[model samples]
Target chain A: MTDEQRRRRGRPRSEQAHDAVLAAARELLAEVGYARLTIEGVAARAGVGKTTIYRWWSSKAELVAEILYRPISIEEIPESGSPRDDLAANIRLIVEPFTDPWYGPALTGARNDLNADPEGQKAFQAQIMSGRRDTGRAVFQRLVDAGDLPPDTDVDYLIDVMSGLLVYRGAIWRQPITEEDVRKLVALLVDGRPPRRTPS
Target chain B: MTDEQRRRRGRPRSEQAHDAVLAAARELLAEVGYARLTIEGVAARAGVGKTTIYRWWSSKAELVAEILYRPISIEEIPESGSPRDDLAANIRLIVEPFTDPWYGPALTGARNDLNADPEGQKAFQAQIMSGRRDTGRAVFQRLVDAGDLPPDTDVDYLIDVMSGLLVYRGAIWRQPITEEDVRKLVALLVDGRPPRRTPS
Candidate 1:
């Protein structure tokens, strides 16, 4: 081991303390927002010393990034046989979490912070574009392989369009995204219906 | 006119000063963001006193709101004969302005502030839902009347979907939205294409 690694000899690290720190960070993020949240506040809230937090995470952005790394397993992407069903479930899962009263605010606050801070933005891009995008692209590829989609279809654009709609609802409109809404969106996009006439 | 209205005559409010203040506010919002922006900052930048700014707008929220009002003119919504073309154009105008280096950062910061501040959030709802919604709704209504859309289609849902996609792109993805992207999105939603296969 390197000298720095050798110096880190102890009880390794307390998983309990780590969880507490993350929970505290989430709570504070929800309450005060990222711009207002501080390492001291997190340390105090977690009942840990500032050194304890710094030992684990070099910065608040790193801590927040770790907190958001909620391992979106492949199993989370449902393969309900039909592409429409899978898409709807995907939409619901993504949208419902952001609409949850407790976690929603924290996620939104962290998201805003990510957009504003350069380092946070890069972390976010890597996490979503590299990590999440892989999962989404995989799901689309499955449907295309099944011959449900046209051979000429743009998979990346498809993923962007679907996820983009959900992002809009959660972040922009700031409205509740119902399952019915997801169904309509999936139907409208997948079914490719002509524009409807306005009722007189 | 009411007595208060009658006595509200001085040198009459200088439209030039009003425009200059808005310009300064927009510039600072692009530079410092909404949370850091202040009446004092706006006044100093605009070469006006704090009282002058306060006379026109009650708070920074109001000033930012007024500043945003400039881009919401009717002409920004397209009427390009086809719903697809019109929708594409409308989305382009809104999305394109945001891509401007100055406008993008300003909007990102403003959006962050709006979501974080309860009062600012309420103001956003009022402006977007009540004011912008009406304008958005009218345009879609016209599209429906023109028989470009199906009679049973939900325009409100459509608006939410379109806006949600753009919001997601700009606010969350931080991706540069292009006219081509807008067209592809329009085709995906309005053209009823099948879902692509998920990538591995």
Candidate 2:
């Protein structure tokens, strides 16, 4: 192992403290939304000094970055061969997880902070948005290949519309993206008919 | 006039100070953006006491609320008898002005602040969103009346989709909702075909 890695692992207290801090952050994030979440509260709950949390993470946004990794990673996009089912699955993967009681508050709260931070925005673009875009590209590309979508479709713009709608609904509007909404979104964006209307 | 109004007008200095405070707030908002804007800064720029600003508007958000009134008021929606033409015009009304050098930055910057403020949020909804929703309702209701949309189409959801995409594009993602983008949006939401496909 590298010298820094060896030093970190050599002290059991440091490792235990790290895990405790993460756990405490998660719990408190769920309890108090991101606006009210404080390093002092996390330190108090984690039973570590404020300096301890500060020593590792410079800002609360940074701490939240670690705690709030993407719930649906790129590798998890369901490639179910049937493009329709896969597209619906992809939509669910993006939209459903944020509706979770624990993850939802953390994400929507941190999103505002991340938007204001230039460095955080870049990191989010790289880490979260790039994956999101790629997953969308895959879905759209498959649809094009399957003759379900026009070959000249603007994939990036379409992705923005779909995710923008879902995110705005789930995060800003605080509404559930119902099944009917999903079906309508898919139909409107894809071929303009509900699945039942299309001949088998 | 009411006694308080007569008293306020009686003091010419008070009227000038109010005008100066508002003008200073607008200048500073465009100069430094919402997050960096402060009551002290407004007072200094206006050559008034901080208490003067506090006396008029309770918070920076309240000041911003007055400064950042909706650009496209609901009454401005065109009723040109042509659904397609009117829909495109409606989209332009909602999405275009924010592209201006002055209003775009102020609106986007204050948007984050407004999201975080509950009282500000209420006023924003009452003043801004209600007007916006009404405009969309009018446009879509016309479309339904003209037999362009399905009889049972969910007007509210379509409004959300259109506004969500445009707001997320113009406000959050910091992209211009171009003419082409507007055309694509109108097509997807209203009917399957672009305007070209429908014979005049």
Candidate 3:
């Protein structure tokens, strides 16, 4: 065989191997949680050497972070011609996975790990906060552009309210984010009853 | 000295020893985290037998859990007559200590450990969820009973919205909860504009 052929052929670092490692990490994170996950265990499960795993990630935390950092895109908002539908879709896309058995455990584990380490916590905050803020901003912007919301409305504040509710429910309450709940949230934000006067 | 006098004398089982153990546990939790904390280390620091701690708590998780489980009382909520003021007070009472330089790290470490263990995670969930829900329900009930909220309003749903926002800010956003933010939340829930209609 030619040198080039020899180099390209035989036991390529297998995309299969890469996927196995990530899958194992994800499973272990759910089962044993972030603190208990080990590089040695991940390597054993993936049938790869510890060196191979180390070559890719510096630590278990970094490996788990990459594995869980699934980018949730908001650009695909359904223009179902109804604002309510659009809002509901957005909420579902964000909140559904948060309640999934796998995702829920993984998320809770990651949060616990992040909170333990200040630096890790900061990284987590930066990654999630920007994405959520941007998505909420996009939703509000669409509403304003479509003349569905007031031009002078505080979009940032509105986004905070909507996103904040989702985060609170998922992280603190541990409640399943149901379709009905999302609908109620949209209704309250859009057409709720009159505000009460503050008592002096 | 008489037996009764002896029983009342000599510092009563050494509060100093108890304080030292807790202090060491707190420090080590910050430095090594909950996953790495050991009873041996705590015993060494406190200059006491490991049996002493074991007599009180079965495991490190239980000890940490006991340390972190604080009941929020009515006196903790400043009676400001306004819902917004009350909300701010509640938020402050919860967040302030969690952000304290010393207490924060230990709490975060314990939280991480709890997340790693399924049983511990369940306990953690029960504590936070029930606590938040009960507090939120009480506040909402007071408001509605006073005629500040509509008679038919869903207190449960409103509690979800309000508490969810606060939890989101604390756990996910990792932002410092301020009086202004709490006030805004109360205002938005109480008086924000209704959602606009989406075109059919």
Highest DockQ among the candidates is held by which one?
A: 1
Query: How many residue pairs of model 2 clash at the backbone?
Result: 0
lDDT of 1 by residue, A58-113 (tens): 66766776655454545897687887677776666666556545444455555555
Candidate 2 on A6-91: residue-level lDDT in tens?
98778899788988998898888778767788999999999999999977776787788667655355467666787777777788
Ranking by DockQ: 1, 3, 2
User: What does candidate 3 score on TM?
Assistant: 0.69
lDDT digits (tens) for residues A1-200 of candidate 3: 99877876654566667778888887777677655689999998888999988776655765776665544557767577777678788777777656545554555556555555667666644675567667767776777778877776666666666777776676444677766677667766765543222211
Residue B16's lDDT in candidate 1? 63
Name the regions of candidate 2 deviating beyond 4 angstroms. A1-24, A38-58, A62-71, A100-112, A193-200, B1-24, B39-58, B62-71, B100-119, B193-200
DockQ of each: 0.40, 0.21, 0.25
Query: Candidate 1, DockQ to 2 decimals?
Result: 0.40
C-alpha lDDT of all candidate models, in order: 0.67, 0.73, 0.65
Task: Tell me the tens digit of each residue's lDDT in model 3 across B1-200.
Answer: 98877766766576656666777776776676566779998888778889987775556876665555445665566556876567666666656544544444455555555655667567655665567567766766666767767766677777667656655565455567666566666665666553222211
> With candidate 1 superimposed using the best TM-score fit, by how many Å does residue A119's alpha carbon deviate from the native?
2.3
Question: Top model by lDDT, which number?
Answer: 2
Quote the positional error of residue B117 for candidate 3 in Å. 4.0
